[model samples]
Target: MLRVCFTAEDLLRVRFADEPAPMVELMLAVATLQRSEAVFGLWRRRMGRALTRSAGPLLELVPATGKGPLFLDPPIPGFDAGLEHVLSTPTALVRSELHRVHARDRAPSPWTRLLADRDRDSWQNLEHALRTAHTHIVAAPWERIRAGFDAERAWRTHLLAGQGIHAMLTGLAPTARWRETTLEFDSTDDVEVSLDGTGITVLPSVYWTGRPLVGRYAQGWFLVYPAVTPLPDIDDPTSTDTLAMLLGRTRATILEQLLRPRTGSDLVRDLGLAKSSVSEHTKALRAARLITAQRDGKAIWHSCTPLGLELLACLPESRGKPA
Candidate 1:
């Protein structure tokens, strides 16, 4: 089992990886597929319309570095020296035009900071944290509660107990400080933690969900500490074969699920199986290149690869009349 701490670095890596390819393509396509002036004109028009209609802030999100036009700090110092020359010249017209050029030429926008905020609030991350916590409970099998704990209550207890442990282990206060804490569960008996801490708790559950525990000191939300383990290295062929052998019925179920995109937890709940089993089967299918798995927070979703579909098409029906 992989012991993982939900850290900013880990979250950033996941964000970078999971950002849709289409968004990148759209940006590139706008520049290359259309005339440069036409592209700029369109952008300017859009900005003008938006500014005209909105009293709210106008914000543009820029990448820190790489393939797109240099918006943020350049890889090399003094790379943007020429920017002043262009913006200062008469060619730079409308204020929006200058803003666009500055955005394109200046250091990356502070939008990343805003993004960080949203990432902290994302539900997807919360789900991931919960799954991770459950896995930990299963692996270690915490003293089973005397009464049958519903998913929600179990999660709440786990979060509270885990928070206590997290404080002991990390020596850090909960990221989401709380004057009061409470827990909630989903329809499936899944758990959720709400906190009222001044800041969000960097606990496992929060890490998985990427949501900050939000609330005031006197009326704070619950804090959940999830048990997280390292994700096993699934790339090893031996690991793949072993997982595949163990999968049996799970293999068929996963294959069917991957005919379309499905999240890890979705598979586990739908199949009425343990998360470890789902994860193991997913690892095998992913290794075989029969399916592709992409991480969206704690949940890693899977889908059938073209190769997998082709292979499936070729399989002979066992009871077919034809040989």
Candidate 2:
């Protein structure tokens, strides 16, 4: 278990990410591809076609398990930054982080030795790998990815406002729980981190939805975890049915709930629908092209397509009236 100890002042200074970090997403995307976790099997399969030679070098950075190198200093470096900032990361910092990882992991490899030698080629190769991965994996679906980031931010904001910081931290993941002054995580490593009044930056990632990544970063300290919502995917087989066939209060309510991106679990809690029922309804809505689903980690995030929003806009004010 991982424990994050906080001072009284730290409690007042907690912050949420304003947006997703492109480099962070790229790293997690590479890790996910390497493992081919069942949750992201579909994404991996789709992205396989886009993989390039650059991806090979970066895969060495992420081990099959354990904390990978903190290449992006300040774990959550870019708040609302772009891809250019990531590519522009100083070579010196990249070399330093790789050395740290090599020292800790003690996993000897030609790539590690090259990076340790401060080989400019190795640094350039890492950057190129990130760039290539971003273009192929994240750039195309960025709109949906950003939406998931926004949704997670909003949800945390709500938790902060309604129940306070403790709620926000513990609610971050099912495994995260608070007990008195220490926040504990169901982690693979037995570690303890003290905030020491530095406060923590809580960043969200669409690609990493499993465990909370806790570390001391340049931006004070941080916890980078999967966003509450998943990146949006629009891959269900389209059907020839018209929206009118499924128009009703229930379907309309589902569309309304999707004004912002949400997940099957979110809908289950809000609408009090059975898991199977929610899944079936979403499938129908997706087939009608009124909603699109993006699978992130294990959760499938749902958002209304333009057509779905347009249909909602045309609906009458009556609660149960069909559009």
TM-score of 1: 0.23
lDDT of each: 0.33, 0.67
Give the best candidate by TM-score: 2
Candidate 1 local lDDT, 51-121, one digit each (tens): 32231111232221112322211111121232232222232132333354446546434443332343444
In terms of lDDT, the poorest run of 10 residues in model 2 is 234-243
All candidates: TM-score: 0.23, 0.68
Model 2 misplacement above 4 A: 64-66, 73-96, 103-106, 232-323
What TM-score does candidate 2 reach? Answer: 0.68
- Candidate number of the best lDDT: 2
Question: What lDDT score is found at residue 92 in candidate 1?
Answer: 18
- The per-prediction tally of clashing pairs is 30, 3
RMSD of each: 22.0, 9.7
